[model samples]
Target: MYGSQLWNITSLKVRMVYTQWRKADRQVLSVSYMTNCDLLPLIAYNMPLESILDCKYISFYKFIATSANKFVSYTAKSKIFDYTSTLSKNMAHLMHKYELDIYEIVSLSKYKVKDHSYYK
Candidate 1:
């Protein structure tokens, strides 16, 4: 599958593909990798990067950490939806269960994609 198609899939599912891709590239070099530090950049570099910047979850965290004052001031002054806290919580939760099993990750993707009514 293509890079954009992968994004539409849940992160739980993509963990496996990312692992395989990593192993194939001989980049990860670790057996039980958790975070997608290597995977994200690899796919990003290989794929057609239409977006000027990758506005993924990690990028969001870096922005908040690197520009805490500016972010705080802007958020306090602006009327943007305050999903920062919620997103951070969710990211932390996902990080706790990080796995690099490809088959399991694909299963997760299928389950999430099939469960439209759960969110509804």
Candidate 2:
């Protein structure tokens, strides 16, 4: 996750990795195959990896937006607002799920609870 903000969150590799993570979580927690995904957070105390990654992307851009370098700030703001970009689409989905906007990303970043519980 050191530089994951630059990754395409919708890629096939990301999905496969997330699947592996879920399988590992299920095994580690001794959860039955029939167990509810929402209940995983209650049991394991962690958010889904992708969700955290999405948050990290937003946070990293927020950091970039603060840069004094004109080129850096320009690029960050450009990517963030580009409706045609994949990152923006993911951001929209995430924001819709959490009822958040660009300004609130930081607030969510400081979240104390490790669990996603679908982050509901």
Which candidate ranks first by TM-score, i.e. highest? 2
Poorest stretch of ten by lDDT in candidate 2: 109-118
Q: What are the per-residue Cα lDDT tens digits for candidate 1 across 1-120? A: 333322522355555665566555445344345545445445444421211112243334334434559866365324223434544343343333342222232234433422321221
- Return the top candidate by lDDT: 2
lDDT at position 114, candidate 1: 25
Whole-model lDDT values for every prediction: 0.37, 0.69
lDDT of 2 by residue, 4-94 (tens): 7656677788789888888888899998877776677678987777767766766666667777899987886677678888767666666
Error of 2 at 9 (Å): 1.8
lDDT of 1: 0.37
